[model samples]
Target: MRNTETIPAELSTLAACQEELVSITQCAEAGISKHAVLRLVRAGAWVRITRGVYDTNPVPVRDRICADYHDHVRRRAAWIGLLAYPDGAATGGCALALLGVGGLPSELAPEVSRPTWMDAGVRPGTVLRRYGTFPVVQRHGRDVAELVHALAQGLLTLPRDHAVAAICDALREDRICLADLGRIRSLIRGRRGVVAVRAWLELVPGRDASPSETFTRLSLIDHGVPPDGQQIVFRLGGTFLGRVDFAWILPDGRYVVLEVDGREFHSGNGMLADDATRQNGLVGTDRVIVLRFPAPRDSADGDIGGQVAERLHPLGWVPGGSIGPVVHLD
Candidate 1:
């Protein structure tokens, strides 16, 4: 009874809508009868995600188990909030999702803010806030809070590791830079979590390419073994030795390379072989010791900080020197 592959001709108008979400009013306008919508819903062809909203995507069940599916769910929630309050703009995690920023928690609550409201009704899973004035920008054709504003909003609420990971994601994606850090601070000024967010900001070098790398770096810092640099490129004579996720220069001028392997970026046979070759090249350089930390299934998988510390201590890396800089992109 499921018809995910084809859209009925009677629902052409709904299919033409910009997003998967379509209102009942819009369906009526498109010449689709209420009976037809009801029948489709009964047939599992259309899903009702909200009171009067339908998700026309009809995605397969198997496809709903991956990270991409989770991201789609986040976007769907944002759309629901946006559709419910047309004048409201997506902010916080909703804006981050729409902007394609990663390193977000698995659970995302849709948030929207508007200057005013009429008959305030209940939005099932969305959070509504009132704001006098704020900067708004369009992302994915929907109104969203500006990048730094959204980051500030998200930072105020996300967990410590998640906040830092989001900042790292923003920097890695070139969505923000060290210069924007001040603006982000200004937005969160006088807020409850400003102190913690500021401390985390100082800890971020904005050079780690993945959330796993950020987490790995944070673990090291917590154990008083922060790396001197991140995303450091090395060269042996005229050949490139490849870039390391993190590196520390010992007193004797040797280097400790920390590589964080996240499944998202490092998968399949090709990536594995490339990683092996890169590791071989780095070791052949004869002045570096490489440490690889793979993605963990649970919090108890391994001690990233302890492992790195074990390698670093033997090389005369003291308890602390200085962490990497949050480089200005400009």
Candidate 2:
């Protein structure tokens, strides 16, 4: 009599999950009985991840496992969800960044999305959702949702500022076009956790070159002073001045240039020298006021809007004004 206990995990088909993990039921469906699973564990070929989930390796070790154990658990939980709903896919930031769909690095919790309802409650470090109207497909051997679906989910889950940065990151990468963002706004309309995302979309001005630019622009608008031109080029009598990230045409016919300095682009001597040269070009007797705000890595922690407001307040920028005096560079 052939013993199922002697069966190996490698040869089991139904037990095969995307990340070398599977549930006992999946093994059973693949002709691998509970005894076979036990045999694999005894042989150190599989390890019990959770109550039902099992890893192919008895002692699976990866670089990520040490750095962040939550990340490891997150991936395992996602596989468990996938075991039941094979059609569903990993959603939110984790999947979006991993799949290159346009999101910040998935530093937050692990989140997955199913087209239909899911049976599991929220697992530790995992946020599951039954959301968005997107076809789930297998990408890179793992289920993934449409870019828009993932993007919207990101906006819904991440903190308000983080969500704005995530959408802006996707926008910078061209992973989702401007029109598609509008489409996402419509698709996620009336959905839970859609209000903040919707409000941000309405506030974000077009033509932002980077996440910092978007964040800074949104801050100004939120502060009640909308910027006039984004990524606007300035020329002083055929001499090309740098294009500012956020700009305002002041009431006195001078321009206020807000140069958002993100560490990646504005750090180091080369960039500093270049920035100084550009600022010099934009300054002088002309009423061109330049305000340099070193943008924060995370918008949530940054008080750039308040700083801008404080700098501009002395120059007569109120909550509802078309233009104000040149914002002080100091």
Candidate 3:
């Protein structure tokens, strides 16, 4: 009989063999045959994952463990340049995990290999592909240092910013709210090449922004402009006057409408003439003040808040304070 207690606890746990590998050696030490180890392997009570590497039936060989083995082989091959691989071909993120960067996804099997490159040592067909030089390379920060090269490789294969923009546009079209974007921003906040992500978010106008309007009224609120009602319908004596972007009603029963002019609203001659006629009608009432902001670009300019403040001051609209170029939301 072999003494299994001779094996270390950590080794025994790692090997998980009922009759430990050390016990087999002990049997040999005691002049017993090595056939007992072979018998255990043949009985399906132990598995040989690799040469000299064995695991008991209770401890399964997971896919990640196998991937790590594959990674080691690829790294060794790459160090010697045995494989003819492409330059700048690396894997990162989930793709890196596929290439055995930090292990495969929990649910995935390790057998499905994808193409990946990392410092020219990555094994091919590990889910990271080398697509020449179409993807852009940007420095990835410390948070994702291990996956930076891979992400750069992937991005190089794709169009610059186009892939990211398409993803953002898809999310926007799906009406995915700002909170979801905020969460994503938080995750990749300090990462390298994240500027593209921020640019994507900027391009996707929020629900509060009007069509063809570059700057949102919500953005205006951040500049110290008081919260104004949106798409407000102006009325006089129960008759519909017109719809205004924002409106303010004073304590003295006076009203002020801030008309935000965009190309869509004041484009052709017909629309401009119609808008003039509407303004004339409103002025005829003598109970309302009309402040017009021509061109959407004006509001986005640096001096917009001051311009707005100057216009509103005489109409009993007081300035809260020095308004910065930040948007405030409730």
Name the best candidate (by TM-score). 1
Best by lDDT: 1
How many times do residue backbones clash in model 2? Answer: 0
lDDT of 2 by residue, 1-330 (tens): 223254455545434334567767667766778877777777666776555567765554444345445444444545655554455577766565545432253344546666666576544434568774575556546677666777677777766665676677677776777787777788778888676568876644366677667667667766766676667777665667777787766455667678988756788999999999988878863668898877655443377777767767677653433332223332
lDDT of 3 at 203: 37
User: Which residues of candidate 3, in runs, are more than 4 Å off?
Assistant: 1-174, 190-219, 298-302, 318-330
| Model 2 ranges with Cα > 4 A deviation | 1-87, 101-106, 115-123, 195-197, 318-330
**Positional deviation of 293 in candidate 2, in angstroms?**
2.0
Q: Could you tell me which 10 consecutive residues in candidate 2 have the lowest summed lDDT?
A: 321-330
What is the Cα-based TM-score of model 2? 0.68
Per-candidate count of clashing residue pairs (backbone under 3 Å): 0, 0, 19
Q: Write the per-residue lDDT of candidate 1 for residues 1-330, one digit (tens) a residue.
A: 676344446556544333477767667777667777777788888877676667776675336665577677777777788876767899888888888888777667768988775455856777875545678888645689887888888888777777778878898888888888888878888877577677766866656778777778778877778878888777766577677788887887667888878878889999889889989988886777888989742222468888878878887887455434322111
